[model samples]
Target: MLKTLTKTLLCVSLLATFPAMAAPDGDMAPSDKQLAELYWQGQESLKKSDWSGALERFRRLETSLRRTEPASADAAIYWQAYALLQAKRSTEAKATLEKLKRDYPDSRWSKEAESLMRQTQGRPNVASESSGNDDDLAEIAITGLMQAPPERALPILRKVLQGSHSIEVKKRALFVLSQLDEDAALAELGNVATTSNDAELRAEAIRMLGISGEDTAIERLRTIYAASKSSEEKRGIIQAWMIADKPDLVMQAARSETDEVLRKAAIQALGAMDASKELRQLFDSEKSLENRKSILQALGVAGDTRSLVGIAASNESEDIRIEAIEALGIADDDDSGENLVRIYQAASSPKIREAALQGMLISDDSDSMLKLYKQASSKEEKQALLRMLTLTGSDATLDLIEAELDKAGKQP
Candidate 1:
């Protein structure tokens, strides 16, 4: 039975790849042998700590691959950022790292970029000599301090946190201190979160406090959020609450916050928590069309597809209904595809019909769509259905259309 099941699964997997065979040639990703060779040469330069040489190679590779090999370009950008860090070009390195994380978030290279970001952001180069041993020693010292008992480590870490060490070293100390259970450690982190001059260091402190998840740490975050005049600081505090899974605090902020952008951030955080009930309640009570749209988006984020369908069905404003219809697609509401088709049939507005058709395509209701195409009375409606099928890249639907066209050709 197991062998039969395995064979069945293998056949199914191969069958799934058939759609790609019918897809347009534009779907193919171009490959370059020269780019691969140059990438390895850059890696060799990095291995030798030849920062300038590596930076030059990676920059050229990134320019070459940006359009043809986006994934490779993302990697090249990450390596370029690392090379910049190693070359003591701090500002450009930080910018490049941020770009990598923003543009290709799902790329494996983003993980390495995040690590380099933490090390390079606020910290100046503290290695007096361009020696690998010095770099090794700094890391080892931080690790050794963290491994020691709080009684032994606290004094050293306290000095490091307060001292004019490089930003990277201070960040390491803050992280280790956050992990410690000592009251003094929490106090130091709280102090840094509240008082640090460097915005990046303060954000890092807020992050560590949130990870600690101590009641006192949370209170500090709240206090900082309430007291800080800077919008950036408040945004950081909200993000820290998100990381700590404090949805209640986020919801509270969403309700009370005056800044439109920050309020949206809180709502997004609630959405990330799967707070469907809260989002749905907000959707019902919201008066502003903009806020209602946000609630629909949040419900989609929380995977509350049922609520989205109801909103799409009943919302009076065609524009709002269109937004909700798209949200249904985001929630992957396969069952709602027919509802979208119904909306399309009823909608007099071109944009609303377009939105409904787009939703159906996203839900992969190609079988229903093919039936709809057959039932269409007018040439315009039939043309619309054919365009939608092409947009969806439905191989079976395409085959059906091709057969119909061939039959027409033979008849003429």
Candidate 2:
């Protein structure tokens, strides 16, 4: 559903089978309070974006309320139509809306609903519309972006940005723009990243530039690291650099940075760059538990076979060891499969053993995998076995399952 046209929302679900099942005096009856509470339940469901849920609750109330008094059925019917619209059950919305206008000629909700039907062309019936809640305005704006295409949202977002949007809203708007229209939004974000007083917002703008992240942005980030008064700002810019895959800049900072904290950050950024040279250095020489752990993660992501030994080793923290074990699964090199078996053999603990099992599932070591399948216990452990069998498409396991199913089904 296009977000722009959803500047107005049109749906929820309403049905209570029992309300129409019997009246208090006869087959069906609910007091005004019960009807009001039912309506409130529908409202709650609507807010959660569970339109069908709301519709079911409202329908029961509608059915029950109709028997109590014909005069009140008007409101129930209107909301039912609204729910149908929200469910993206549009044919039903049209039907219910038609019923509303035909049966209740003077309802305010019906008239407004008719207008909604006219306006909602090209809109997916389920598109969210934020109501008159100022406190949730930024959230509404975000919701609008989530629903609206960049073309449609761009205009509304431009209006919000141009208007007196709250700082929070401005930040969210910048993010939405960056995601929706990366090239164009980068220009706007660049202005923010360069000049905004809110360094967090500036950093966010830089991060959102995605693949359009520019050399100018890189240099600006470097300059920010070199000159910013706040440590937080430098950290933010460094993160932005890492996200843009500017490993060279990160390596440069790690080699020459003077401040101990910033130097550590630079080193962390180098590890984050997921570059082979830096990953090797981290695996070989980094002495800090934290730093070595970070580097191992980089190695895992870099998928460099050289780090296979270091990742397979148990010298680092359990967390790093676990990350390294997982990394082997993704490495896809000849020795990667061997390294996983080695880790599996050497690894202890339920967790590392399980991680090793997972890694081996991706390895070509079918013999070792077959052993794990026989020994693994618990549903999750069995699931790992199934994943191994599934991904590898092992003929033996497939034939086993098929044979078992055939025996149960009595197929020849």
For each candidate in the order shown, give its overall lDDT on alpha carbons.
0.72, 0.60
In Å, residue 118's CA in model 2 sits off its true spot by 37
Angstrom error of the Cα, residue 97, model 2: value is: 40
Candidate 1 segments exceeding 4 Å error: 1-136, 333-351, 361-377, 392-412
Q: How far does residue 188 in candidate 2 sit from its true spot (Å)?
A: 6.2
Tens digit of per-residue lDDT, candidate 2, span 1-412: 1123222122101111111111111111123333544665776676666778888887887786777766667666766666666566777877887887787787656546665466345455454555325637666757578567666777676676666766667766775675553345556666777677765556556555422356555665666567767655565566566666777777766556555465566665664455778667645765566556445545654667567566567476677677677656645566776777667666677668766665655444455676666676666766666666654556776775676578769954
Please provide the root mean square deviation of candidate 2 (C-alpha atoms, Å).
Answer: 18.6
Off by over 4 Å in 2: 1-163, 166-191, 198-200, 208-211, 229-232, 253-274, 310-335, 343-369, 372-412
Cα RMSDs, all models: 13.6, 18.6
- What is the TM-score of each predicted model, taking all chains together? 0.63, 0.41
Best by TM-score: 1
Residue 71 in candidate 2 has what lDDT? 64
Top candidate on lDDT is 1
